[model samples]
Target chain A: MRKMTKIDIITRPGKLEELKEAMYAIGVTGMTVSQVFGCGLQKGHTEVYRGQEYAINLLPKIKIEIVVCEVPVEAVLEAAKKACRTGKIGDGKIFVYPIENAIRIRTGEEGDIAIMDPEDVEK
Target chain B: MRKMTKIDIITRPGKLEELKEAMYAIGVTGMTVSQVFGCGLQKGHTEVYRGQEYAINLLPKIKIEIVVCEVPVEAVLEAAKKACRTGKIGDGKIFVYPIENAIRIRTGEEGDIAIMDPEDVEK
Candidate 1:
């Protein structure tokens, strides 16, 4: 019955590795990363190919999602912000949510156990 | 203030279009799609490339995220589930979270307004 919070970090794709390393350093091993398209203050850019102009409305971004119960939410937020900081408009955004449950299909683990590394499980 | 809920659906990439159409039919337009990698009961596969064997433990997944305040959470959930249903192990998973707030960077709108379509905005 541990409480869990899910952190969604959307930022420049190039900064993913830095954020990953930072989170991992804090023992937050399990995460889901995705390539996304978003429109922020930076909006998008226009490109021409084969003499045809195309407007790309959504800019490319990366989303790192992690659900944790033991890790402090503030610590993870700081780590993500530190890694993603660029003092630019399109540095991206972070969203925090309260997760009700998590289930691991392989092992049928639930809650906090579902997101933990196998090594952390009892051998 | 309106209570907002964010739904995160992780499923096969191919099902994205179907889900989008379904949600749109229900007037759920604002969403974020991401290309992600995950491992469930499927557990990925092994491939041979140029006389080398590569084991991909994580399979490709598409995560569709939508934050809504007006749409009924159950309706959106049912639509996503119906569209993503395959009766297969990897058909996907749905994670729902409570969202505190949403902001639109372009106009500095917040809360429910941030998620509304411009067409839905007043003249």
Candidate 2:
């Protein structure tokens, strides 16, 4: 069984394209991206709209998920941070998880093979 | 330190509301949901538009993530499976990961407290 690590990155939605490009440049292409709402240290700020104050608890964010096997986790982490950094609060966070197994529904491929590209199968 | 577990469920987008209701009934709230694209056994299908064939390799998927400490992992897992099950291909998958710690940005609350609601603080 191959040891697989899953990285879930929650960051500003604007940084998604750059992150994608950076990951692609690093030869780590497979990923699942999603739009999410969360509250961090920045939590929610009060907004005065038409003379009324409203508190927004959940903030909009983007989440990038990448499950890697052969690729170096450190490299991916660095690339992700560099791409998403804005030097401000609510920039987002990254969570690492241990994946027990992965299966490609189409091919019924399990473990790391389910995550690799067809071209990279030879590698 | 509280023992925290993160459950990531990939299921049909339509089933999200029901799953949420089920979890809420089980006293397991606080989740992050996202729209993700993936290829499972259902992968992608060929569509013919204007007599042109287009192969879609990735399918739309909804990912629901919940991090809990006091809630029994077994109960959450069962609730999720029961709500998301359709006994069909591309129904989705569930993943469990051990969480080291969680901090609520607004209150600086850490561990399980960060995950609990303010009303539940006394409990």
Prediction RMSDs, each to the true structure: 8.3, 8.1
lDDT of 1 by residue, B1-123 (tens): 799988887877889889989999998967898778753311243433345644432467788888888888778877877787765445555666787898889999998988888778754
Instruction: Please provide, for model 2 over A18-40, each residue's C-alpha lDDT reduced to its tens digit, 9 standing for 90 to 100.
Output: 88778777667366777788754
Instruction: Provide the clash count, candidate 2.
Output: 4
* Candidate of highest DockQ: 1
TM-score of each: 0.55, 0.55
lDDT per residue for candidate 2 within B31-107, as digits (tens), equals: 99877874321124343334564353245778888998889877887787778766544556566677799998988
**Per-residue alpha-carbon lDDT of candidate 1 for residues A1-123, written as tens digits (9 for 90 to 100):** 788888989987788768877887776745777777776432365533345644653667787888878889999999888999988556778998889766543444556776666546554
